[model samples]
Target: MKEKLSFKKGHRGRTVFLICDVIFLVLLMVCMLIPLMKVLVDSVDPSTYGLRLIPKKVDLAAYKYILSKSSLYQPLWVSVYSTVLATVIGLLLTTLAGYVVIQKEMPGHKLIVGSIMFTMMFSGGMIPTYLTIKQLGLMNRVITCVLPVSLSAYNIILMKSFFEGIPGTLYEAAELDGATPMSIFARIVLPLSKPALASIGLFIAVGMWNNYMNFILYITDADKKNFQVKVRELILSDGLSGTNIGISEDMLKNAMVIIVVMPFLIIYPFLQKYFVKGVTVGAVKG
Candidate 1:
């Protein structure tokens, strides 16, 4: 009778714990859902109902207005070009660095790893970074956006950790087969590290796509403006400031927001599986 009572108590405790977990999860999801739902509603709404939860009317005029304007296309192209270039370059450099540092016998590996990790914890502030960029003669050019911040320490560390998780026997086998380091990286490591690579690439790509500070500071030419900076100018432009800009202020603002967010929304779903797996693998290994 005592044993049966104990089993019943255990079952009841588990049921209570599961009920609490469900409640917590529901609340967390709702917190995330509310903001997303609000954005969708606002994006479709004709009128900006200030601070209201719901819109009185729905319309796609804002999207239409933004898409119809030819002026937005150049900045969009610039953003795309810079983002793609940066993502590719950054991924390659970071992966190479990570792969090198993962070698246990590499000379000064500890010092290199320490320095890289130190940079993650410390940074030369914006003024110094801007000054360095100016010295490099990257100012007022599209390359300024892609070249200045090509390699990130956090990404290198994550990639290194992922690489470290691979079995040492694989490296030994490759060595026995007369595989060069580059060959091993290209053929074996890369294939196995897809989740990590995809995650880091997406991260870098998103950062590049959303970058405004680099473009604003380095590229003074209005013609070289990225989407975010261009959007900012459009948002702050009062009707009296420019009669020929064509698009209305409210419509432009909404449209720019949509444009900024749309790419991430579209791409994230496709990479959702890899993203989750990469994050899990990195975190577990770390």
Candidate 2:
């Protein structure tokens, strides 16, 4: 009778927690939806309508204009190229570093992990970072945007924690089978840690896609600038001057925002399952 009552209470508590979670999710969705809907409406409507919650009319003129303009295409490509390169490089390096740090017998492992973690809590200021980039001959180059901030200390820690959670007996078994560390990592660890890798990869991809400060500070060439930097320049130059530029400022702003965000929207949905699973596993283990 006591066990039955305990089980019933536990079940009831879970039900209540689930209900609360659903309510919170619904409210969060509504909050996010409002701004997204506003941007969509503004992108399609004529800007002269002015601060409208609902669009007066729907049209694709803003998108059409932006695409047709040659000036926008190069920056868009630059941003895409930079983001892809950075994400790939970041994922590889972070995974390797994480794996190394999780090895209990690895020499200087603690010191290495400590140094990496220390960087997470602190960083050199922008001026110093820029100077270092200049000293390294990365300034005014496309590689500069991708290389400087490729591997984040936080992502490495998360990945290391995920790796550490794997049973040590598995590694011992692999060794008994004459498996080297590389083989064990590739065959056993990599397959088991897909969720964690996917989550970290998505995080790195988003950071790369949204990055603008690096481009602004390191890239001086207008043609070398990424989409975000280009959009800012366009907004400042035309919006502040009150020059029509054959398109309404608001429409341009809305269109640029949509362009920047649309890729994330498309990619994130497909990766949502992996991201959730990986994050949950990592959290539980860490």
Candidate 3:
């Protein structure tokens, strides 16, 4: 009788827990949705500038005005080129580093990993970094914005952990088959590393896409700023003065928020499967 009661109690508890989980998820969706709906509705609303659940009239002038800015194009181009270059370089270095460190027979494997991890704990101060960049004559260059920030210690560790999860027999077999390290990496390792690559590449791409501090610090040229910097200026500034575009600050702000996040929303769905698998693999192995 006691065992029966205990089982009944446990079953009831699980039912309650599941219900609570569903409730929590619904509430979270509501919280997120309300803000998104407000932004979407307000961006096109011609109504007076105040919070409302619905719009009086749909006016798309804000998006049109913002899109028409010639200044926005240069920053968009900068972000595109810089993000692509940075992701490519970051993935290449991360893959190479992860592959090398996983080869326990390689000289200084632990030393290399330890050195990489040490960076996560400490960094040269901003002043010293600035001086180093200045000395290298890279202060105002686009490379300055991407190269320094590209190789993340965290990503390297994650990649290393992911690679470690791969079966060692595969490497041994390749070696026995007279496969060179480069050939094995390109042919065998890379084919199996797609999940880790997607996860890390997405991380690097997002980081570079949203990067602004580097541009703000390294580049002095007004025309060379990234979209993030331009968005910051737009959000913080008094409404575009001396312009005939009849749009409110709130509309532009909402539109900017949507524009910035839209790319990730579009890209993430495609990579969701790989990202989930990769993150799980890296996390468990690490």
lDDT sort, best first: 3, 2, 1
lDDT of 3 by residue, 1-286 (tens): 9999999999999999999999999999999888877888888886746657688888888878778888889998998899999999999999998988888988888898899989999999888998899998887899889986679999999999999988989999999999999999999988999999999999999999999998988999978889999889877785433135677777788877778777887999999999999999999998
Candidate 3 residue pairs in clash (backbone atoms < 3 Å): none
Candidate 1, residue 279: how far the Cα is off, in Å: 1.2
Inter-residue clash pairs, candidate 2: none
lDDT of 2 by residue, 85-159 (tens): 988898889888888988868888789988998998899988998899889888899888787667888888888
* lDDT score for candidate 1 against the true structure: 0.82
What's the lDDT for all of these models? 0.82, 0.84, 0.87
RMSD after CA superposition, every candidate: 3.0, 2.6, 2.4
Candidate 2 total steric clashes: 0
Question: Runs in model 2 with CA error above 4 Å?
Answer: 1-11, 47-56, 239-247
**Cα lDDT of model 1 by residue, 158-263, tens digit:** 8888998889899999999999999999989999998898899899999898899889888999889998888887777641122255434554465567678889
* Cα lDDT for residue 115, candidate 1: 96
- lDDT score of model 3? 0.87
